[model samples]
Target: MKSARMLPVLVLAWALALGNILTVGIAVHAESPAAAGSLAAPESFGSISNPDQRSAAFFTELGKVLTHPRCTNCHPATDRPRQGDLRRLHEPPVSRGPDGFGLATMQCSSCHQETNFDPGRMPGHPLWHLAPAEMAWEGKTISQICAQIKDPKRNGGRSLADLIEHIGSDTLVGWAWAPGFGRQPAPGTQKEAGALVEAWVKTGAACP
Candidate 1:
C-alpha cells in the first residue's frame, strides 16, 4: 500500500525535474547569441530627436569595439602592449619603440607578419604595431576616449573627417575583427564600426 502511494509522487518529481532542465536549457540556448558580441546599426539610433544625443549614442555603441580586448590590448596605457583576451601583459616584455613598433631588439615585425600564423596562433598584419601612446584607450571611459579622439594632439593629428577614413578604411584597424584562433574578435564588423563613426561625426561627435 505505501509503495503504491509513493509511485505517483515519484513520477511527479521526475516530471518536474525534467521540465526544469529543459526550461533552463532552452533559456541558455536563446540567450547565448545575444551574449556574443554585436553592434547596433547606425540607422537604429535615428529615432532620437536630439542630434547631440544621437551622436553620443552612436559613439557609445562604437565604444564596444574600441574597448574590446582586441583593440585595447594594443592600446595599453603604458608603453608595453598587452596580448590575448585576458588583457595580460605581453610576454617577452616588449616596449613600444619610437615609431610605435617595439624596441629595436624586439620589433613587432619580428613575429607579426603580413598574415596570421595559425600554427603558432600569432596574429599579423602588414602594418602591425601599437597605437601611439597618446592614443592609448585602456583604462579610459568612453567619454574620455571620445574626448581624446577629437583632440588632434592626442589623435595622431586626425581631423574628425580623417577619423572616418581611418576607422572605415584602414586595413590595420580592420585587423581587429580578423584576429586569428583563440582570440575573441571585436564586436561587429569594421564597416559597421566605421558607419557609426561617420554618423557620430555628422551628428556632432558628442561624447557620452
Candidate 2:
C-alpha cells in the first residue's frame, strides 16, 4: 500500500524532471539562429505579467544550463574537478586547495591553456580556477541554486541587479555558450540565458 502511494509521487517527479529536460531542449532551439530574429527574449523579471510563475519558469530554464556538465564539472561538490559528460573523476587527478585554484604548486593553469580547441590537453583561461566553495553546484537542483543565488552570503555578496549583469555579461559565464572543440556548449547561448536571468530578477527574483 505504501509503495503504491509513493509510486504516484515518484512518477510525478520523473515526469516533472523529463518535462524540464524537454523545456530546456526547446528553449535552446528557440534561441538558435533559426529562431533568433522572431523571438523576443525576456526583457526583465517583472516584464512577465505573471511575476511569480514566470520567475519559477525562468529558474527552471536557467537550471538546465546550470546543471549541464560544463557548469557542474567545475562546481563539483568534491575538491576534485569532474570531466566529460559522464561526470567521471578527472583523469590526472586534481584538488581545489585553499585558494580554490588547485593543490599547491600543481595549479590548474599548469595544464589547461587559455583556449580549448585541443582535446589532447585540458583547456585554460587566464583566470582558470574553480568557483569559490560557497558556489558549489554539483549536486544541487535548480531550486537550491536559485535560493543560494539570492542569498548575499552564498552569492558572493552580489545583489539581484549584480546577478543580472554577472550572468548576462560575465566573460567566464559567456564561455559556456561557446566552448569550442570537444566540449558541448551549454543548452542556450549566454545572451539568451542572460535574458532569462534579467527576466527572473525583474520578477522579484523568486526562488524555486
lDDT value, residue 33 of candidate 1: 31
Give candidate 1 regions above 4 Å deviation.
1-37
Error of 2 at 14 (Å): 37
The CA lDDT at 52 in model 2 is 87
Q: Rate the local accuracy (lDDT) of all candidates.
A: 0.91, 0.79
What are the per-residue Cα lDDT tens digits for candidate 2 across 26-76?
999988643434223565444556778878878887887888888898888
- Which residue pairs show backbone clashes in model 1? none
- Residue pairs in clash, model 2: 44-199, 45-199, 45-202, 45-203, 46-202, 46-203, 112-123, 112-124, 113-123, 113-124
> What's the distance in Å from true for residue 80, model 1?
0.9
TM-score of each: 0.85, 0.75
Per-model root-mean-square deviation over C-alphas = 3.4, 11.7
Residues 1-208, candidate 1: write the lDDT tens digits: 9999999999999999999999999889777533665689889987999989999999999998899899899889999999888899998899999999888899999999899997898999988999999999899999999999999999999999999999988999998888888887888889999999999999998999
